[model samples]
Target chain A: DMKVTQMPRYLIKRMGENVLLECGQDMSHETMYWYRQDPGLGLQLIYISYDVDSNSEGDIPKGYRVSRKKREHFSLILDSAKTNQTSVYFCASSSHGESSYEQYFGPGTRLTVL
Target chain B: QQQVRQSPQSLTVWEGETAILNCSYENSAFDYFPWYQQFPGEGPALLISILSVSDKKEDGRFTIFFNKREKKLSLHIADSQPGDSATYFCAASEGMGYKLTFGTGTSLLVDP
Candidate 1:
């Protein structure tokens, strides 16, 4: 089955600490994305990776960065976690050519910064 | 500014009734629209979608009514069930683009 997987479904970190969220997709999609969901704010895009080493910032990319070293894996890193950064993070992947609009999302990671 | 907007932040409907979710966008360049369903504690999943070229698109019991002139669209869920109790998001993307701008969402509750 085609699936997207994320590690550490739940995480807690002290303010100013570092964080790493990993995502993997078995579909070998060329486009991968990172999004954060906050109450009443909907899903805000953080970054979009078109392919290996080709990444673009989304609407909200501050305090966060992404890495795509392979076709099936993407990573989101928080250099200095802040309390306001606490939210559910989602990782999604989509095909390159036809219907790239349909993004298959993973289970998501609930991160809390204290 | 919020490019996409959804109404009825919350909605309630009987199991056999139809639920209507409204959405609007400010970007005229957005030609593709998709609705996503999210269960509690899970990421959102694609439920249905419509292109600006079409006025209506249907799949199963879900239908999307689009009006390119008005820059508005809506999702009608026929025979809503308790299983349909979840959050629905309206998202839009520019011409054949990958970045999607999403609305806040509507929390739907289907009572049985």
Candidate 2:
């Protein structure tokens, strides 16, 4: 089955702590994205990864970083967790070229920074 | 600045009724528009999409009506059912594989 998986569906961290959210896909898609969704603000893009080791910052990348060491895996890291960072995180993957416009999303990770 | 915007933060409709969700964008460069449906505790999923070249696209009971000149679009759900109740978001992107700018979603309730 084609699917995107996110680990630690829920996480709670203290302020200033380092946090890691992992995502994996089985479709071998070349493009992956990380987004944070909050009430009223909707889904805000955090990062976009085009294949292994090629990542670009999205509009809301200030407090987040991403790693894509493999085509099927993408990780979102928060260097120093902040209370403002508490939100639901989503990971998505898509193929290259024409089909890149369609993204398949994972279940999502709900993170709480206290 | 919000590039994409949605109207009627929330809407309630009876089952089998037609529900309309409105969306508008500010950037002229945006060429691809897509609507997503998200249920509570789940990530958003693509519902329907329309390109600037096409004025309308239909799939089953969902249709997207686009007006490129006005930089606006709307999603019409025909015969809406309780199962279709979810938050709907409007999003736009300028180029292929580019990050999408999303609008604050419209919470839809289809009461049976």
Candidate 3:
């Protein structure tokens, strides 16, 4: 079975601190995505990596940056964490080719900024 | 415009009852629709999906109803159990290699 692993199930950071959320997938999927889930706001895409070193901004990319140094790993960085940035973050991977495909997601990381 | 829209932000039902979750899309180019289910503290998982060419698809108790003309679809959970309590999200995509637009999600609570 394909599995996506995320580091630090829970995190608490101070305002202006740098935060890094790590994700690794065993499926070797070509597409990876980062999303934030907020109450009543739903899941908003933050970034997407099509391949190694290839990153694309999503609708909500402000205050966030992403890196995919390797095909199996993707990282989300918060250069300066703020209170408004606290939310549950999810990492998803898909093996979609020419046809649309389903994405497998990680357990998620809940981050709190104070 | 919100590409995907879901109704009944929250719903509660007794065990064995059928729960219907509705979803609609504005983009006519959307050819693939997928329903995702998420439990508390976990990420959403692909529960079921259907294509534009198909009107309905079923997997056990979960069924998808599609209306091409209306550009709407629905998820019907038959014989819902307490374990079914979770949030369901509906997503749509136009074609391959594209990002999916997701609905706000509907919370379903199945009481025993």
Q: Pick the candidate with the highest lDDT.
A: 1
Least accurate 10 contiguous residues by lDDT in model 3 chain B: B92-101
User: For model 1, what fraction of the real interface contacts is kept?
Assistant: 0.83
lDDT of 2 at B76: 97
Q: Least lDDT summed over 10 consecutive residues: which range in candidate 2 chain B? A: B92-101
Compose the digit string of candidate 2's lDDT tens values, residues A7-114: 989999999999999999999889999999998999999999988999998998998899889899999999999999999999999885655477889999999999
Higher-ranked by DockQ: 1 or 3: 1
Comparing only chain B with the true structure, the TM-scores of all models are: 0.99, 0.97, 0.97
Chain A TM-score, each candidate:
0.96, 0.96, 0.96
Q: Which stretches of candidate 2 lie over 4 Å from their true place?
A: none
lDDT of model 1 at position B19: 99
TM-score for each candidate, following the candidate numbering: 0.98, 0.97, 0.96
Strongest candidate by DockQ: 1
> Clashes in model 3: which pairs?
none
Model 1: per-residue Cα lDDT over A1-57, one tens digit each: 989999999999999999999999999889999999999989999999999999999
DockQ of each: 0.87, 0.79, 0.76
On lDDT, the stronger of 1 and 2 is 1
Provide the RMSD of all predictions against the true structure, rounded to 1 decimal. Answer: 0.8, 1.0, 1.3
